[model samples]
Structure formats: C-alpha cells, structure tokens
Target: MPPEDRSTPRARRPLRHLRAAWPVVVTFIRSWGLMALLVAGGLAIAYRFVAPPPPATLRIATGPGEDSAYSVAVARYAEALRGQGFAVELVASEGSVRNLELLRDRRVDFALVQGGVAEAGRGAGLVSLGSVFFEPAWVFLRRDAGIGRLPDARGRRVAIGPEGSGTRVLALALLEANAVPADAIIASPLAGAAAAAALLAGEVDAAVFVSATPGQGIGTLMRAPDRAMLVDFEERAGAYATLLPALTPVRLPRSGFSLPEDLPAEDIVMLAPAAALLAQADVHPQLVSLFIRILQAAHRGRQVFAPEGRFPSALNQDVPLHPDAARWYERGPTFLQSWLPFWVAVTVERLWVLIIPLVTLGLPLIRFAPPIYTWQMESRVLRYYDDLRRIEEEAAAARDRAARDAVEAKLKALDTKVATLGIPSGYGALLYALRRDIAFVRDAVRTLRRG
Candidate 1:
C-alpha cells in the first residue's frame, strides 16, 4: 500500500488488539444478551399504543316483533350504543329462553333473559351483564270465574304462552303450587295479544301474561275497569317457593295497576324475576366490560319496568355475575354514562397497557438472557488455565511421592470443578470436549513425574 494511504504500525496496534479480542467481545455480548432482547420487546409492546378501533357493530337479541317490551329494550340499547358509534342489530326472539339460547349459540352478542326459566341445564355459558328489567307475572281471570290464587283455575281453560317462554315456565309453577294436576288443567300455549284475546273471548277463563310492569296489553286490560280481576299472590309466597324455588316474591304497589282509582291499598304480594344478559365464558374481557357500561347507561335513572335503578342490581338475578362485571363492581360504580366516549376508550386500551411492561422488559430479557449467561459460565471454566501453569512448574521439581501426590490431587480437584459446572442444553458436547482437554493435560503432567 502507498505510504499516504497506509496506517502506521503504531496507529494500527489498537486494531490488532481489537481483532485478537473480537471473540472475547462476542462472548461478553452473548452474556447479558437478554438486556438487548428485552429492550426490543419493550419497543414492540410500546408500538401497540395506538388508539382503539371505532365502536363495533353489535347484534342484540330481543323478544317477538316490535310490540314486546323486549323489543322496546332493544330500541333503547340501540340508541345508546349508536351514540357511542356502535351499530346494534336487534334480532327478534320468542322470549327469554330463546334469547338465552341465542347467546349460548353465539347467534347474538347480547340478550335480555328472564331469571326463572334458566334452571338446570340451560345456563352453562351465560353471563349477566346486569339486570335490564323485572318481568312481573300478571294473571288475569274472567270476572265471574272467581279465581283468587292460581289453584282455583285447575279445571278451567288457561293460556300460559307458547313453549320455551318465561310466561309458560312461571304459569306451570303457579299451577303446581295450587296442587293443580298438569293433566286436569286445560293449558293453552298462546302469547302476547293472542293470549289476551283468548281470555276476553271466553276461549280461556284465565291467562298468564309475563311482561314489563304496566305492560301494554295488560295495561289496556287494567283500563277496562272490573272486566278482569288481578290474582293476589301476597298470602301464598312461601307456598310459591316450595313449589318453584326460582320464583321471586315481589309486590306491585296499588298505584302500579291503578289509573283512575287505587286497586289495592298496601303492597300487594306478587311474583316476578329479573331478565339477565349472558354470554360465553371465554368472551373477551374488554367486550364484557364494554357491554356492562352500555347496559348501566341504558337504564341509568328511573326503571323502565321495575322500580327505578332496582332492575340492574346484582342481587336480583339467578345466575352469578360475570367475572368481568364483578371486576367493574370492585372499582366502584361505572361513570361511562356521564363520559361515555372517554370510558369506552379507557376500557379498550386498558388491556394493552397491562401487557406493555411484560413485552418490553420481561419477554425480550427472556429471549436474550441465555446466550449472555452461557458466556459468563464459560469464563469460569476458562479460569483453570492459570492454575494449571502453576501446578506444572511445581511438579517439575517435586522431590518425593508425597509432594507429587499433593500436586496431582490439586490438579484433580480443579478438573472436577470444571467438570461439574453446568452448561446449556445445546452446548453439552462443547462442555465434554473442555473437560477432556483438562484431563489430557493432567495425564501428561503425571507421566513427566514418572519419568
């Protein structure tokens, strides 16, 4: 090389040392290697800090057509979710049982299911977002039929609603409480306006209607003044539970059914149950939390069906609260109704935040940590070189068997130390080779002493 272009030997001295020690540098890099990997992981986790996607399109399962309170509830939920940028689809269902079945099958994302119908095998994958409403049991009888409690209508024709409905389940329980034989009663499985029509037209002497309090059809009937009589269930509550364990005893205040004149003075004994929202166990925690906030918002102030704020409480339902819902309760009441958009954002981003530190600091360290640790471990074995030199000098001038044996034992002990140090799983062969080299040197020293 030309003198002008060439680096002087003195100047290149640092380069030569660096080149010689490149392997040592690489070894150090391998040790504590986890630090670099952990930093990278941390960066990857941090990259997930973007804003969440817009509110999703959801499907809510509601009862019947547009006439039922189930349908009315759907409208209310849709309106609220829409304000939060969610597009909610309302699927028409037969009633609570069908709503719960849809939720179990993943056919709909949400539903309003009455409490009593879900007894034995029906409630595996469901979760209550919270109670949306209480479905009051309204049993109307013909004026002259004189049916006070449920048992009096055993021989008479009755409409309890179609199959797989909350009304049918409750009606069966009411009759069983009265000791009315299932075969003795003429049970008609009709629903909504059809059940009402059957009772008014005298095709059925009594009809059981399960709907929100002051329900439209029952409200219309109550307006007719003495045309039909409401069954008073106050006296027979314990008897009611003995027959149907799931039936909750409640009261419809005198003003609930009365418009122009008070019907009954004090609290009247009535039977009712809450409708719950349920979902699969594996449903995403964020979605579960989001749905709860929306539900609480939809029914914030006054109760649409039961007493104000009483419908959504935890004590009202037959099923246990979803874990996600339980967590929200732990954090105190939800404020999403007042600051919806903010809370929605908060809910979605919370999970990502929790995972951030682990990815950034924990995971990267896990990946890079092993190689770095191996290098440090290898250095401990490498330390035998200095001790071996010192022993070789002492063995050359050994005067007796005792001195020779002492030097040999020291070398043997060092060999064992090197042998016992654990190596990585993939480096087992390398460790064996290192131990074999140490043994070969020790054997060479022993042969020299014999000579």
Candidate 2:
C-alpha cells in the first residue's frame, strides 16, 4: 500500500479485442449459406413432387331426355359439385349406346351408361364411378295375356326400344336368350311417352320398358290398375345369364313397389345390370376423386335399386375406371367431401391440398433452423482465457483486498459457468487443462499469503 499501484484490474472485452477473428467469421458465413441452400433445395424438390388440383368443370353426357335416369343423376350431381367449384355440363345422347360411342370418341368427360352395352366397347380409356342403380328389364304384358318368360313372346307382337337405345340392346339380348327368331318377333321401335301411351292404348301386344320405378314410363304404367303386369325373372335366371353375362337376378320385393298397399303379391326376382358412371381414362385424378365424392354422396340414401350406402361401390361393371377415379375410390374419398365444406372453403382446400407438399417439406426445416442459426452466430466468439491466468493477473495488479476478492469471485463464477456450457465431448482435455491451471494458481496464492 506504500504507493497505491496505479495500474488497476480491468474487465476483458473479448468481442472488441478479437473483432478480426477471420477464421470464425468465414465459418459462420459458410454455415449460413449452406443452411440457405439446404432450405431452398428441399423446397424445390417438394414442389416437383406435389400433385395439382383438377380442372374446374366436368362435361358429362347424360341420357336422351331429362326424364331419363342419366339426366336425373347428372342434374343432382351438378348440385353437389358446386361446393367444389366445379361446373357440370349435361350433354344429351341418343341412349346408352350413343353414350358409349361419344365416350369412345372422347367427346365427353363422363357418361352414365347401362352395364352390358359397354362390354364389347371396353378399352383402356374408361373407368367406373360405381353403379347408380339397377337398369331393370321391365316386360309389361297385357293383364289378360298368359305369358311368363321371354320365349312366350316368340311369336307375339312386342315393342323393343328404338335402334340405338339401351332398351333395344337389352331387349334383343333378352329375346335372343329365349331363342326367339329376330325375324319372327315383331319389334316396335318406341320409347318414353310414346311407348307408355302405346301400351295403354293396346297398340303393341307387349312393351319392354327399362327404367327405375317410379320410373317415368314404367311408373306411369304401374299407376294404371291391371294395365300391365311386371314379368318376374325368377324362372329365367339361367336364361338371362346365357344371353347377358352381366345380368344378375335381382328382387323387386313386394313392399318395395308400394310400402303401404303392397302391390306385389311376393318378392319378384328380376334380371338386372348396374348403371355405371363412366369416365375417360385421361380424366384428371382430382376430378375423378371429386366426381366419386359427389356421386357417392348423391346416391347415399337411395336403397331402392343399389344397396343403401353401396351405390358408389366399384364393383361389377363393364367400363374400366378412369385412372384418376380408380385412384380416389381405391383409397376412398377425403374428409373435405365427407364433411361438405362451403364453396369458398372447399375451393381453398382443393388448392391447399396441392400446396401441402411445399408446407410439409418447408415447415420442418424452418422450425429446426433457429438453434442452428444461433450456434452459427455464436461460433465467432473468441475463446475465454483459463481461470489461472485471470487469477494471477488479478493478484499481481489488484490494489486492495476488496478488489482482489471481487476478481477471485468473478473468476470462480466464470469457471462454473464455462463448465456448465455444453461444448463438444472431445473438449474434455481443454477442461482438464483449465482445472489443473486453476489448482496451481490457488496453491501459489495460498503460499504467498504466508509471506
């Protein structure tokens, strides 16, 4: 204390002292650039792998008339598609045969066609949305006439549908099964209101009406008491198969016709094939998914023809499914469809799903990067001196016990804090060297105290 040491201990400023640590600066710059490159590369790859949304409108070919099943179905389907921002156009065709023809020509995006008619025309370009209902072969015979099977009508006058109609295709196949000579069976080419009026007026001996009930033509006839009898197919199941391989024996249960009055005496077995929603193979996947969702939802409550909750099944059918339709039905539809969002949300979701890959791939990299960024920033810090050097400097330069004690406490705190910091496992040697130096300095300080 004789001459208070003019030199006083001062806090070390690592940042100011080592501002030009070029190696650490270069490492930091390299790491930041590499992280950016990794993020961008990952995002670009994800964008390429992502799937896009389908087109906005679907052009569907319905039936010849709005009264027909295909027309009815497409109309209802259009309503469901509104939420998806899809506009459906219902195009007119002569019948199922013409529907298949337009489909072959790629004239339409989707069509509803009778099952067996599309068999011979089957190619890679078609896919099924599911059977909407049974397109039954309805044989309306005069109430007084005694006939049961197709063979009974061999020599009798009959009304088959017009040339290209689905009715004609089904009628010929059925009549031929009964071994009726095409020339002998008097064929009347009539349909719809004309056919229904003809049968009521008794112009034709029998009318072959193919429709869903309360079908426009058939239902009109059914409402008339004893005008025509629905011919049962229980006896001709084997014959139906021989003529039309696609035919399956279905039952018009007595109660199904009229729940209260019970028009049918008993369950009547009848031949049937499923009507399918056929689409071109090239139809986009998102559209196919959207179409199936709408079609399935539309037919959900209909249990009269196809099984309830089973109308949109991808079961037996002639046309192959559009690849997109197959993909959607295979995995089943999404929550958006089942949940039925509003138009705005549905549109946003369709777009959102497309961008999902970008977000999924990008988010993890973004969330995982902050700690890495902080480490990269701090990597440039200059290394702190070992505690022994700091303590020695303090003892040599410190003027009073208070200053010496304060420096000793600060050194101890620095040592404790550094020890707790998680450095690389290989840095144990550096820690051991620091501890050894600290012990040596403490011993030297104690030895000098006895002086």
Candidate 3:
C-alpha cells in the first residue's frame, strides 16, 4: 500500500475502535453513573455544614476625629488587616456609646467601647475580644473652683462631655453616686480638646474626661499644673468601684506624668474603666483570632497605669468574651494556625469535619464499588448458559438425522447471538468462557447427527 493509503487505514482504525467502545461506555454509565451522582450530592451537603469563608471587608467604629486615640489605634488595626488581605473601613463615631449603637445596628463589624457605656439590658448580641486599655475618669478643675473632691463640683459649671459619649455617661454615673443632682451642676456638652480648652480658659469650673493616660486632652491639662488640678477620688474610690462593677480603683503615683516637675504632688486615686474591643456575636472565628493577636501585640505592654503584660486581659469586660478570643487567650493558636497562612489555616479548620467523615465512609465504598460493577457485567454474559445446556439436551434426544441437524442449527444461532452481544473489554474472560461452552455444545450435536 502507498504511504498515503496506509495513513488512511491508521486514521480509520481509530474510528472503528471508537465505534466498538460505544457499547462499553454505555454499560459503564449504567453501572456507575448513579454512584457518581450520589458522591457529588454527599459533598454538596457536607459543604453546607462547613464554615463559610471569612468576609473580605470589615467595618470598624472608632472614636471621633483622626486625633482621637481610638481612631489612631483602629487605623493601625486597619493597616495590619489590610496587609493580611482584608479591606477595613474605619467609621468615626462620637464615642463608645455611638460605637455600641453602630455595632448593635450591624452597621459595623467591630467597635471600641468603654466598659461602663454598655448599660444593663442594652448590650445584646455583642462580644468582646478583651479590655485593651484603661480609660480613667480625669476630673480636671480650675484652682479658683476650690474643688477638692468629686462632690465639691456641685453647683459649679462642669464640661461633662458631648451627647452620645462614654465620658458623659460615666460622668453622670459618678455625679449621681456622689449625691450630686443632675441639675446641680451647669453641665456643658463639650468633650476632649473642647472640654480641655474650656477648663483652661476658665469657662468651666471642672471638666470630666474618660480617656487613656496618653490622650491629647489629658496631656494638655497635665502640662498646665498652675491653672488646673486633677481631683483625687481617694476617699470614695473603693466605694465607687463597688457601686459600679465596671470601675477599677487605679492610683497614679506622685508626679506620675512628670517626676522632675512634681506635677501630681501626691498619689491621685481615680475610678477607671477599661476600653474593650467589641464585635458582633456572629463574627468569623478567623477574624476574631486575627484581631485578638493584633490586640495582644498592641496592648500587652507596660502603660502608665498597667504593669507590663497586664493588658489585653479578659478582666473588666462589660460584654461577654468572644468564644474564639477566649480560646486564643486560654490555649493560643491551633497547630494548623501556627504553621499555615491565615486563609489556608482557616480553610482547613472549617473543612476538617467534612474531611474526616468522607475518609472514614468513602474508603470502604470505593473498595466495594469495583466488585459490584464486575458482578453486574459478568451476569450480562453468563445468563445465556442455561439456553446452551437446553440446546445440548435437545441434540441428544434427536429422533432422526434431520432433527439433529435442526438442533445443531439452533445451537449455531445461539452462538452467533452470544458473539454479537456487546460486553466491556474488562469482561473478556467471561465472554470467551461462554463462547467455549457454545462450541462444546456444537461438537456434541455433530456426533449425534452422524450416528
């Protein structure tokens, strides 16, 4: 044959083989298609139970303005989260009260809230990572006001922070505890720098501030010792702490802010509340873990009031601790979390339950499926054995040569049907055995015909 003709036969040979394979393909589908569908369905149902991937974006509520310590701290959090492939939106708010409102409304995923701001029957469906820092009640008074203690501010002008502010809430609580009526002081709605400015300008007799020691307003007031003095809650600190479960008795040692200048000449006792990082109850565990790690790194150090490794603590939290955060604090990160990247670790953790069941049940099913399929295919070829035996008996009982020949012809037709039947190549041994039996029957029939 010419080269071209030889190539044509080679190409046509593939087509013939494909045509021959059509029946085997059909038979295999009949056997295994249902099994494939079942496995797929099982996987889909398992997936439903798995924890969903963490959200790509997170919204956080922080204190008002870029200058606020809350905003600055949350800005750092946003940067860290962004580096780990999350998009963080920082929403500035009036204070902890507004932050709580944003969190309750589901308008933000996380918020920095003061310990005492979340009142009874109001803080539902929220959880805390932990208290990150202390926000002390810094009551700055002008020298002319002659205010030696919290109650002495009665009937005097007081800047009690703005509306929807944690400072305002705490100030009212402390004043009420001191037997100072709400109407007794001329309350000013100014806060932070405005409150500090008002107190410095002699516009207000006293200003109540709830903030970290490093806050700008507190720093500004501390710098001017001649003009303002911080009130000492020495006599009632223990009593106030008992009255409000959120408040902790904190003492600032002599000259805590400035030792050389003898700024605070004596130890100043104050009632301090912790600032907690709050999140929705249903926040993703991965995000919770990440935030907890960030908070530990940020706050687990010595501060003006707290000792080294004292903060990022589960202590003094107004809201319940997040389960994941609690776990992190108790037992640290999981083994996979310690080794793998953030998303990879979370993915594996989420799917681990599904994987265990699949391995346990699926292995046995996989081993059993091939044997079941083999038996089904072999039965297709073996069912004709009974017909072959009946033909052999008819040949043996033939009354004449013509009768024997008719029996032989019937046997030949049966053999042809068996040969033409479509069976998979894997079952060729069964097909050959059936063919050999048919030949045996033919030989016996021919011998009877000769007799």
Candidate 4:
C-alpha cells in the first residue's frame, strides 16, 4: 500500500446506493404503481362489456327455385355482401312460409318473407329490416275455365300453389273470403313453372301466383295471354286489402311486361303484399346496419309497382322493425359509416361506449395523480422528524458527557441518513427543511454540552 496506488478508483458503495434508491422505489410503488394497477383493472372490467365483432359468415333463406325473384334478389345481396368481406350461404326453401320457419328455427340468419305469411304468434324472436318489394297475387285462368271472379272458381280445378308458399297462403285466404271452402275446389299443390304448365295444358282450371319480378313461370303465362288470362281484382282489390292489413292494392299497367306487345291490354288491379327482409332478433346490430345499406342500394330504383326510393321502406313491414334498422331508416348512415370502411366504422362505433367512460374517469385521475405522488414522496422524508424529535429530547436530558456523546453520535447518524435520502428534485425544499430541523436539534444539543 506504499503510495495507495494514487490513480486507482475507489471501491463501489453498493449498500449506500441501495439505501438512497429504496425510498424512490417504495414511493413509486405506493403511488404510480398503485395507480397503474387501478387503471388496468378498470380497463379489464370495461372490456368485458364491450360488444364483440360481428360474425364473418351469414346464411340466408330464399325461395325454392334459382329463377324466382327471392332467389335472384338474395343472390345479388350475397354478391354485394361478399364484396364487403362476408361469406354468404343461400338456403333455398319452398317460399315465404318456409323462410319464416327457417328464420325462427335459427337455421338461417336472414330470410325474404312475404308480408302476410307471418301470423300473430309465429313471428317471435324475429325482426324486419324493411319491406324490399311488392309481391302481387296473379290468378291466371285457362281461357275456357268460365271463372270470372274468385268465387266463380268454386267447384273448379285450381292450382293454389304448393304447401309452405306465400301464394298458397294468399290463395286460401282469398278463396275463404269469397266463401269457397278448401274442399269445394279440386286444389292442386302446384307452384312456379309446374303451376304455369298445368294451367296451359288444361290440367288445372286456374293457377295462383304471388311473385314480385317476372320469372320463367310469370313470363310463360304473360306470353301465352290467348290461352291463359291474368284475372283483374279490380272490384274486390280494395276489399281484399282491407280484409288483410298486409295486402296493398297495386296495378300492373298495360304493356307493363313488354312495351312492344301492349301486354295486359288494360290496367290489372291486384292485391299485393310486400316482401320483407326478416332477421333473427339476436343478429348483430352492425350486420343489421350493413344489410340496411345493401337494401338501400338494391331497392331504391323505380319498379313496376313502386316509385323510385319508395321501397326498402319502413312501411309495409309485417314484423317489428329492428332497432338498428329503425335508426338507419330514421337518420340514414352515421358519419363514421359514410366515410370509413365497413368493419372500421363498426369497430369504432362498438368501442365508443367503452372509450367514453375511460375518458371521463381518467381525466380527473390524470389531473390529480401527480399531486398525490408528490405528497407521498414528501411524506416519506417528513416521517424522519419523529426520530429527530426523540433524539433532541434525549440530548436535552443528558446528565453527563458520556450520555451527551451518545446522543450526538445518534444525531450524526441521522444526519448521514437524511443526506442520503433520494427525494425527487421537486421535493428538495421539504428535504432541505427536514435537514434544517435536524441542524437546529444538533445546535441545541451542542449548547447543552457547553453549558
């Protein structure tokens, strides 16, 4: 140790360093660390209540044949939804009656149901987006059937449509209203092209069709006007509409089918029921909104019976309107929906409920947490004053120099501990005051020693 190796670095004092850092670690854990835990807990609770993302896949029930209006319209809907990142599977059923059954059983998420098919008790757990289009009742008769009116079909061969069809439902209701009992007519369970072919071949005296758009069956009947004629419900159209609240009186104008042919030759007044887009009540609100938007794009154009923008309408719905669809109909799309991508807009709308509470609660915490942290830090330093007061009392009561030296030694230790405290810069004034109080105690002890 001759020259003490003058240039050598001193050994590190790890214990003193730990002592200085300990208070800061404790203060942070007691203040900011606890605050962080509180915030994390709040977020966890909020996340539990957050709405989950909508399903990526959707299933819809349409009519039996691909050529039918229900099937064709739903196919277009599937295409549009697929463009927006959805996987759509179409389930073909008999008609509106079967579609309603599929929707109620949860076998399908959505269905195109004719308005009058959903009876009072059968529509539970279902809601309507809106009425998409009108489906008119077309009663086509063989030219020699001698059936002038609905009641004239009594005791005659009639194709009233197959079971689980909207046409059959309307047919039975009209026949019943006209006092034609089910057993009174030879009722053939024929529909679509089968019904059309039966009437053309004279196998059935009459065929009832409830369709929106002209398809193979309707087109065949319209072309063969000489063999088959669409009956005009002119006299009883209003009466039928009144009997069935869902039925609306509509007219198929002359040449409505073919402008060159002057088809119909006269306005054909018919009783029509709207085809409503029905959904399960539990369907996601975002999906409902998306469907409404899709329907708006698809049905806003003018059609044979409806004026432009008259469809996809809140009116003519058989079931209660879905809350989300009602909002969309009332206010149109939200600003976020108008600008952002579909999923992005949905995500923001879903999270908005969570974000609001967090902001409201976090703002006040943010405003006050720092002050609380400072108080905690300063309190740590202030706690030493109790020991300082105790040492001062012992110094004043000292009877001899031995006692006085012991008290002074304790005072020096306390001063060294205070010097090593790791208070933040902002709290330096409180630390300095504590040190000054210790100094005053030391000065009093020294005066006692001298006396």
Strongest candidate by TM-score:
4
Q: How would you encode candidate 4's per-residue C-alpha lDDT over 9-111 as one tens digit per residue? A: 4554555467778878888777766666666777778888889999888999989788888998899899999999999998989998999999999999999
How many residue pairs clash in model 4?
0
In order of appearance, the predictions have TM-scores of 0.64, 0.66, 0.86, 0.87
Clashes of each: 12, 6, 0, 0
Task: Candidate 4: give the clashing pairs.
Answer: none
1-451 in candidate 3: lDDT tens per residue? 0123354567697775577567767767765775666666677788888988899999999897786768877988888899889998988799989999999999999999988888695678999988888888998889877887778888999999888899898998998898998899999998878888999998999998887765777778888888899888888777898889999988889888788878678899888899999988999988888888788778888987889888888889887888888888889878988889888898889988777557755766677677777877787788898888788788778889888888888888888777766677678888888888888889887876666
**lDDT: worst 10-residue window of model 2:** 1-10
Error of 4 at 270 (Å): 2.2
Off by over 4 Å in 1: 1-38, 42-55, 261-267, 304-306, 333-451
Order of the predicted models by lDDT, top scorer first: 4, 3, 1, 2
Q: What is the TM-score (0 to 1) of candidate 3? A: 0.86
Cα lDDT listed for each candidate = 0.70, 0.69, 0.84, 0.87
Model 3's lDDT to the true fold?
0.84
Q: Point out where model 2 deviates above 4 Å.
A: 1-34, 143-148, 181-184, 223-227, 255-262, 265-267, 321-451
